[model samples]
Target chain A: MNDTSTRAPATRRGKGLLPLALGMVLGALAMLVGLAEAGRLKPREPQTVVALGQLLDAEHRRVDLMLERGDMAGAIEALEALREQPWPDHEAGGDVGMQLRHDVYGRLLRLRLDHPEVLPVEPQALLRIAEEGLGESYRELDINPFTARLAALRGEVLEQLDRDDDALAAYVEALDMNSALLDRELAEEGAK
Target chain B: MGAGALLGLSACTAKAPLTAPAGGVDESAAGGDRDDASLRAADLSSLELELDRSWEELRTLEDSREPASVEAGAAGPGDVVDRCERIRGLADRICVLSDRVCALADEHPGEERYTSACGRGRDTCTQATEAADRCAAG
Candidate 1:
């Protein structure tokens, strides 16, 4: 009877330890999860990605103004500055910066196509840059209708380079993909 | 005391932090309200139509000459620059209107600041459309 009473307290102590261990593990897990959530909620850096997009748009307007004023040299200089701007490789919101970079490239190519004298690089080189930009845009979005317009633009560039056969092939491919590509502008205009 | 401490810990973990990802210029920051967004989008659409018509006029004046394989032979240099200036004017107006709307969206709707910004945008867009019409007529 004396041994039974002594062992009873020890049995109660062992049962008590299980709840304490479980409590500690749960507390640790809660702390870790809270910290992770805080990290995820941290605000994105301000005036880095969004501001850069605004700056690019402003510069494009400036270049257009220079062109309108018949200041070809000034336009070229502005375009060079635009090319030098460091566009972000990626952003959390839909890769906006990368898309803007492609748009800047498109503007430069259009300017060169309109006035070859204003371009610092050869027409062929500008065309190649445009082709690469459009190709990447098409692949990334997987929008087939848009590719038809891009391919038509590519055909124009190929013709500029005196590659008649290739230009014809691109035109054919664009048509085969969608005849409506020719009326793309009409659709936009009608929407207005 | 131990039980009280455990209760406090549980209470702290029960409430989670807000999950809104901050800093990017989202719709709320770009247009303020649904009404504002639809109005601005309509304004933008009108401007786009005007721009297309201007381009068509300019192309016609150029005798359908392609952008490539050409060097100022489409029309006189002066005419080309004049047409370009009109287009640039319209484009600048768009930039101004958009920037103002975005800035106004950052402020509360009840504030006078929002009213003034929207007013300016409407005025500018109206003037731009008139100018574009004149350009197309010429």
Candidate 2:
């Protein structure tokens, strides 16, 4: 009887080992599958921040050329096209690209207003979309020049809207900011 | 020990059967929900485009003068005061356009599209009008 009991316990132990081994293998496979599914196992794709910046910079130059030629319609159309393109990941350029693009769009809209004979529409609606895309980045980033320009452009738009007091205030604000910016640049030059 | 092992295996197997059904139900519930972000983005984009076009039109009118008047001025056919009146008319048109743009901007404040565009169209329109007024006064 004692022998039988001992042999029975051994048999049970041997049976438990198979299931335990199976469970371990199954658990490991599950872990690996979970990791893969979670994207933890995948290699991260590199973002092309520099390339995107270059592209945006080139676009800005083209838009600028259009503005210089007083081609307000062309500038507006080009900027609309530019805004349609996916913005670079904010992490890649730290919101600077976003701010630049936002400011550029704002400038284009203002130029449209400045030379309405060409564009014929204010583009305030389009600018609002672009601005929303720009979000807090405009406020957070050190994009004073771009913001100032936007403010100036906005002031022009306000003037077009006939809110004289508001327009004057906006222009004055822009002028003050621009003056301050110029002073800062002069001070930096002096320091240098 | 064998009994304990058997019990654990049975419990796991029982739980496993319940998991698949519960997972399916959860997935169906999630899938049935609407995606608000996509809808909002679309609405904002469309509205932004509309406002932009309007603003652009206002700007264009501000920049151009009646070619006939300019030619008349160069020919010096009209009285100086009359020519100034004509110039004032052009300026008034610009101011009217500016006011219209500002009205549109005001109509859509805090709208997803307008808010993103700069939330300052009204301010911009106001400024443009004032400038036009100044030009007109001159």
Candidate 3:
């Protein structure tokens, strides 16, 4: 009877050990498979910031040409395209995207100010976006010469609209800003 | 299994099916309301600013005349004539802008500020255009 009871206990222990051992082996196999799959996966490609910059530059040039041709609608269309692009987040170096958007919106605002009759919409919307996106940093960065140019263009538009006093005020403000820009350029040249 | 474990599993299973429908319905309704409010607010503000700007332009043009600094010898009759013609062109543009503002104001009835500004702008543009025409003709 003692020997039989001992055998039964050993059989029970064997059953438990078998399941535990099988589970451990399966778990290890799963981990290996996961590691292999991870190693085989391709790294995410970094976004081409330079290409985006070039695209924005081309768009700006196109907008300028359209404006010169008096094709306000075409200019507006181009600007809309630039603004609507799915820009990467700022964490992904999306400041360039924001700058491009701000520049495009600023140009659009100036265009509307110049030719309000053709725009079919108010300038405030464009102005608000430009202001919100760029803020004072626009003047500070001065990367896009277009901001100052747009300001001058806006003054011209106000003049055309016959708000001479306001136009004159705008012109004076632009001239002051331009003088500051000139000084900065001179200082940079001196430094170089 | 214990009763508690069974209850927990049931709750987890029910959560996926039951919460999804309710969440979707609530989100869609909220999104629709948000979009409508944003669009309406933007439209109203834009129209109001447009009308105000038009009126301001009209006032400026009406008040603008050759500077007292300009003697007959300093600026010839041709200069005066050119200035008058420019003024008339501006007056016409103002009139067109005023009419547009009026139409937009009518479409958005609750915007009292826009409606009043448009009415005032239209009157100002009319007066300015007439004055500019007279000056140019003279």
Candidate 4:
């Protein structure tokens, strides 16, 4: 009876210690997780940076070659094909995808504007293309000449549509972006 | 080598043989100063033609590399140091040719024809530069 009674406390004590130690370990883990997620550390994007360079290169060249051969319709068709490509979102595809879309759309618009007879797209249709190309999230992407170009082309399309007020506004937006880019480039050059 | 080093080396790509200065008149063949001047003009025209031809060759090469690069491979992977070396070489050739055209236009002042040639040369340079930059960035 004495041995049983003595060992009972020790067994209870051991059981108590196991839960306490496990709780301490779990509590420590939760604290570390909370600290890490408090915005001190930048959360990496869920997707890796998209590398669409080779894809863009080939598409760009294919269009260039078509233009070089004086095949305006062919060039326009090729660009339309590019537009149909399965593009990932900004988070998934990164800024390059956005930049490339801008470039592709800009060229398509420019060609349609320059050779309207080739593609025979109406001004209203062209405006839709421009608006669609500059998606809702475009403003959030990094400022780049391709984006600026798409913006400028949007202005041109607006002008053709006779929305002079809207055209001016678009031009102003593009100009502001371009001037900032120029200033940064000049600063970099000066520093160099 | 590094991409930067490849770009640098490409910048020094050998000048086209046709880019040889058209100076030093062959008085023996011309037999007169006016004729020598005419010969120089001929030489300039010939150089411009050759430069245009060379530029086209480089452009064609650049075009040929485009078909399967995005779909298949750039002949293979491009994660290595010398990845865009071929692109740099093509761009360099076109760049040098365009520069020669610009120089020729500059040397002979007051020629309206050269003004147009210079404009085209500038366009070619811009295209080549953009291509090189895009390729290297990849």
Q: Which one wins on TM-score?
A: 4
| Candidate 2 per-residue lDDT over residues A1-192, each given as its tens digit | 011221122232333455334433332223223323534222121123323434654565565455456565776787668667766544443433444455546655655554567646545653464345445545454424445556555655555556545555555455444444434433543575
Top lDDT prediction, candidate number: 4
lDDT of 4 by residue, B16-55 (tens): 1112222333323343334434544544443343333322
Q: What is the DockQ of each candidate?
A: 0.02, 0.01, 0.01, 0.01
Candidate 3 residues B9-55, lDDT tens each?
A: 11111221112122224222344333434433433333233223322
Model 2: per-residue Cα lDDT over B40-123, one tens digit each: 333233323322332222222212222233323332211123323323433343344344434445666655543433334344
Which docking band does candidate 1 fall into? Answer: incorrect
Q: What is the interface RMSD of each candidate, in Å?
A: 29.3, 31.3, 32.7, 31.3
The native-contact fractions of the candidates, in order shown, are 0.00, 0.00, 0.00, 0.00
* Candidates sorted on TM-score, descending: 4, 2, 1, 3
- List the lowest-lDDT window of 10 residues for candidate 4 chain B: B2-11
Name the candidate, 1 or 4, with the larger DockQ value: 1
Q: Per-residue CA lDDT of candidate 4, range A36-126, in tens? A: 3433112132122112333555555566566556777987898888777766566554454455566667778877887889969778988
TM-score of chain A of each: 0.52, 0.56, 0.49, 0.72
Those runs of model 3 whose alpha carbons end farther than 4 Å from true positions after fitting are: A1-48, A88-91, A94-98, A132-144, A147-177, A189-192, B1-138
Q: State which candidate, 2 or 4, has the greater TM-score.
A: 4
lDDT of each: 0.41, 0.40, 0.41, 0.48
How high is each candidate's TM-score?
0.37, 0.38, 0.33, 0.45
Per-residue lDDT over A1-192 for candidate 3, one digit per residue giving the tens place of the 0 to 100 score: 011221222232233455333332332222223222434111121133333544654565465456556577887777766666765333332333334444556556655664567746644454444444454444443332334444544545554555544544444444444334333433543576
Stretches of model 4 off by over 4 angstroms after superposition: A1-51, B1-138
